[model samples]
Target: MDRVTVSLDELPIRDDLRGQKPYGAPQAPLPVALNVNENTHPVPPEVADDIADAVARALREINRYPDREFLALREGFAQYLGHGLDASQIWAGNGSNEVLQHVLQAFAGPGRSAFGFGPTYSMYPLLTSGVGAEWIGGTRGHAYELSPEDAAEQVERARPDVIFLCAPNNPTGTPLPLDVIEAVYDASHGIVVVDEAYQEFAPRDSPSALTLLGGRPRLAVSRTMSKAFAFAGARVGYLAADPALIDALRLVRLPYHLSALTQAAAGAALQHATTMLRMVDEIVVQRDRMSATLEALGYRPSESWTNFVLFGGVADPAATWRALYDRGVLIRDIGIPGHLRVTAGTEEETTAFLEALAEIGAR
Candidate 1:
């Protein structure tokens, strides 16, 4: 009995999955949770009432399969995006992750490769592998910035079937310049996905990759309700691209993948877009405050256009993470050497996180 070893390694798993660990982010109930970059603000009562009413109406038809086309939801999204996109050009999924998977499944497969700038969203390589495609991690320049020349050069060499560019990127909080997006789009013969999951949090003047969608048949821009809409639990994400590209996604997506309740809830939220997104201004304020605090303590905080700040120069990020956790404030240590990411919470939560970390940083 003592010699018996129990483990998943003994099972017959896919060769590619061997020794691979499941994705992990701390979900423990802490005094303050700024780890996942979630919009910490709860849905306003007025907006919540509207969503509840919509979902309740949807519940009456719960026995039936949801709309496979999700046209109404698409129309809602098109109206919200307001970039002259029609319903035919918009596609949605359970989340931006699922939307990404749909894009890869439809465009990438065995014998094809995908490329992304290094130290960006950690999910890019994982999603590439999930679609049975080869993954190429391309290098970014200083401060995790993707330059046009580097983007073009890498795309030319890899000649990948798919390319992912994350704007206001996940852990680094570095937003890509539009010229870089165009350079990659021009260089790539295959599909280009500009993930704008954090678009709502960027500065007003920060250009979105959506602006470059015209005349670029191969490009798509992905966005989500999770970040700024305070709709993470609704699990709605969408993309805008050429109608032909959206049609291709239809081939791979499972029928009725988005439930009726989800569509109804998201549509309701979009109807109250102004109210749902009101917290964004407040979050941006706190984000800048966090940046200022980190810099004042002599840490190198990345220039953030998102609701989170990535700071560097931690003598020991792991220890600091542990120290913060001990104090009931949780943040993310994204495995980037000497850096940590913290989401902007409410004023009180932000104050607690900042005060707790200040002592640790000083020590």
Candidate 2:
């Protein structure tokens, strides 16, 4: 019963994964946690009741495996997305990370390369390397913007086996224009993935990459319920693509990957999509408020189409982060030099962060 401690290097781990770090944010028992870009609002009681009822019904069949195809959940996602999609054109996993991993497994791996714009989703590289694929980081334009020309040029040069385009890109929250997706798709001859985990937070009138899915057999749009639906605890994410691509994913997924309970809970949440999305508007208000307040306080807040904001211009990021941490308000110091990212939380939480930040600036 003696304690045993061994470092990862002592084991037979892969060479590529030798020095790689796992993806994560700081976890702490802070009063206000805006670090991980989660929806801070509680689910509506009525929606929660519906989900609980669905889960209860699913428990009656607990002994049975979930539907391998997850047809009903796919149908719910198709209906929720509503760009003339259907169940056959949909696939899902525990979360969008797993969905993206499935893509890497089927399309990338073993001497192939995956490409993404630099400073994008950190998971793209990790997922690629984990699958034995080389990760090629492409460049973005000024202020983290990716112009159609620049994006297409980069894709054409790398010609990676799989391309991940994080729409309204993560960490920085810079919006990605549909034309850029079009340009990248046209330039690359490989599988194209548009990670739209934050699309719901974008301007309502803006077009989605889903609009470009038709006739594009190699393209996929991935989404998650964790953000706007306040379903992070349930861990549901899905994709919309050609039925052939869906079939490709089926090859790599474990049997009965989506549990009956997960399907039931997500399906019930989709049924109350309207109620769930009402929280998005409030979060958007907080996001905008945070951006404006940051600007007024002399920080350079980036234009965000997601539920979070990445602001720069801090003179001492480490000291400021420590000060905020000490104030019991937690946000992300995502290693962008003077920049830090924060999720849009409830009104009171946002106020607390702003007040803390302002106080730090004053001192």
**Candidate number achieving the greatest TM-score relative to the actual structure:** 2
lDDT of 1 by residue, 1-363 (tens): 578766888888777777776677988899899999999999999999999999999999999998989999999999999878899999999999999999999999888888888888888888888877899989887788888998899999999999999997887888889999999989989999999999999988877888888999899999999998988888899999999999999999998899999989999999989887789999999999999988998889998988899999988999999999999999999998988899999999999999998888667
User: Which residue pairs collide in model 2, if any?
Assistant: none
How far is 112's C-alpha from truth in model 1 (Å)?
1.0
Model 2 lDDT tens row, 1-363 = 999999999999999999889989899999999999899999999999999999999999999998988889998899999988999999999999999999999999998999999899989999999999999999887699998999999999998999999988998999899999999999999999999999999999989999999999999999999999998999999999999999999899988999999999999999999998899999999999999999999999999999999999988888999999999999999899989999999999999999999999898
Clash count, one per candidate: 0, 0
Model 2 misplaced regions, further than 4 Å:
none
Q: Which ten residues in a row have the lowest lDDT in candidate 2?
A: 139-148
